[model samples]
Target: MHALVVDSDAAESSFLSAELQRHGFDAQECVTGAEALEIHDKFDLLLLDLRLPDIDGLEVCRAVRATSDIPLIAFAAGDHGLDRVLCLQAGADDCLAKPYGLRELIARIEAVLRRSGPARTAPRPATDPLARGSLCIDPLTREVRLNGRLVHLTRKEFDLLHRLAADPHTVHSRARLMTDLWGYPAGYVPDARASRTIDTHVSALRAKLGAPDWVLTVRGVGFRFGRA
Candidate 1:
């Protein structure tokens, strides 16, 4: 995979580029968001720093997302919740706080790529709609309905729900879900982040479906479809 690293800090850019290279990615470095925008089409993923010389990384992310769904991971010095949320809201697939470990960065990159890769690009299989109680999911149409009413869901949200609903009796571990949903190996993603990601999606799914009990949480274990 090829990655575009946009950061003005020479040392940080070099470090990120080298790490990406070591992980079998062809790394390209750019000091400004403008440069990143201009050449983003050439790369598979973008490693964007929030602080850029020309344009803010968030703007760059929005601009790129307007035309492309290419995977993007934003890096910033602040590790605050709002910072992370803003990055995600601005079209970033993931966010990394500065001083992050290289392993974590690599894991995030791979995870984002897996979601946007060719594996997910193929046409979905034509299967009969899955019905459990009032919820229904049509795999072929990628549509979900709750109590016969259409329910809108993000791509990741639907994928997560489908995975659990596909095997309602099995309680899927967060680590396992992380691997299946985001392609992050068990040890590659931090436990807290992985849990948060799953929890957030589950919460969104429950809210959208208006059926809180549709997806049951197994406390410290993980989550499963159906009632407790």
Candidate 2:
């Protein structure tokens, strides 16, 4: 698969790009987030550095996520806990603290892809439920079971949970979910109400699901299921 690496550091960018290429994947390097957005749709995945010359990587991640669902991996030069969280909140699939081994980077890439890959279109039973660790969601009954007990969820909560559970590790933006759940009707600008509604639904969903952190906040973008 083809991947793009967005980094301002020339040597680091070249090294990562070359390493990805050596692994039999087509890789390209871009020096700025602006450039990355200009061609975001062309790549399958993105390796983005939190620091950039023109824009913060979080902004880039948010912008790209406005329309695309491409996997994003954020890179940091040091242990910036808040920055890493911001990256994840910004719709990055995961973040890598700086000074990490190249092998670990590749492994993360593979693991993210594997975890986010599409599920098979199967004929689910009338009450068929799927489980991932302690989380369980029943598609037919619209019931959520966490730790083997029925949990309560509002309509929007159920919809949001269903959406996230549809694809583990897949990053989704608030705008996307709003459209999917509420349809936005027409000519609606995403405002505080939109954000609050989604957040409320997510909060209730998490409380009932018994895994508050299962739904992750990607800073300025939206939320995603699974860990960053």
Candidate 3:
């Protein structure tokens, strides 16, 4: 399942998004109402912040409701009773206040999804092995074969590689990579040494596979699967 998190606060949006990703959702961040309104149809659900820099969140709700019935969970800055009511009236499935616990958020999300129906369960992964050049990844077997021979990889290395390779060329931020590679919770900014964890894994993977081109460093961003 994919989630679109729309919030003006960069830290808050990224935190929620990364938290959602940890809960088995491919979460994307949108910082403006216009961007949310434009690309929202691509997601299974929307976590909309009522305070947007561009357009009013209520108007966005109306616009989305006019065309689509995607599940929406409105986020208020505080315990604003009127805002929550307006959100529900404007087609939001549910409304939540900020500083919400992950369990509550997940519960609300599941409840909304249940009421929406059809997408009650997340989609399953593809069965076919992902092949890129002479490198092949098999998720089911948790194996990686290079040039017809199996290449030994640590659990974390395999996971990191497969994650990047899953979406070739898509940049995964260092924070996101650390969160996924380790079990860092949302809002937990990694230390300089801890952030280097991914770099070490990437280095080891390159040494093992003898293919440094397989994963490309994105400088200040993160790593992406190269088109090797």
Candidate 4:
């Protein structure tokens, strides 16, 4: 496993790097945001310090998010509520306040890595076709693959994909998806928050697949499942 540690403090960066190496990770250290950005694609995971010499870590997170959905954890020395929230909203998968224990950090890293780890090797294709372009979905195994490459997805995410892929080219309104997937009647509740939940799951699913273009948003309607 590979990781990128972006902490300006030499001592802190060294300590993190050493600990990661001890745990069997090939860790790289970058002291500035610019350097981190330049080396982003090469690293599997990022240990981003919220404060950098060139820019705030939130900006860096946003920049990284624009191109990739690589797992990211924000580490900081100071307490900044807004920054922490912004980091998550901007695209970070996790956050850690500094003065943190190495053991805890290691645990968090392991957990995140495990969650993002690759799925088992390709399985035999099922009878149904739940797919978009090169991506294929299997409800039996609760898995989706792009060109035979497994794309990891959470339970809710897999369900959402299954719904869409089960009927490709068919547009399903958000209300319909929420009612069908979440088992909530549309008119039962006035708020209809379940509909919005579909949006979040779709966004996350797209990000996980590294392509938001697959799920087309039909203006004033719902989403259509198909490759553009």
Top-TM-score structure, candidate number = 4
Off by over 4 Å in 4: 118-214, 218-224
lDDT by residue (18-98, candidate 3, tens digit) is 889888999999899999999998889999999999999999987886555578899887888998888877767789987
> lDDT for each of the candidates?
0.79, 0.76, 0.80, 0.75
Q: What are the root-mean-square deviations of the candidates from the true structure over C-alphas?
A: 8.1, 14.6, 17.4, 7.8
TM-score of each: 0.55, 0.55, 0.52, 0.61
Locate the minimum summed-lDDT window of 10 residues in model 2: 117-126
- Listed per model in order, the count of residue pairs whose N, CA or C atoms clash below 3 Å is 0, 5, 0, 0
Lowest lDDT sum, 10 consecutive residues, model 3, at 116-125
Q: Model 1: residues >4 Å from true position, as ranges?
A: 1-70, 75-111, 115-126, 186-190
TM-score (C-alpha) between model 2 and the true structure = 0.55
TM-score of 1: 0.55
Q: How many backbone clashes does candidate 2 have?
A: 5
Q: Tens digit of lDDT per residue, candidate 1, span 1-228?
A: 888899999998998899888889899999998889899987788889999878978899888865555688999786788888888877788998887988888887777777653243333444888887778889889999878889887666888788788788999887767766665644544465456556777887888777788889998778899652
Per-residue lDDT tens digits for candidate 2, residues 1-228, read 999999999999999989999998799999998999999788888999888999988889888755455778999779879888787777777899998899999999987775344323322234557676777888788888777888866545666777776776778787767656655533346686467657767776666666778798888878888633
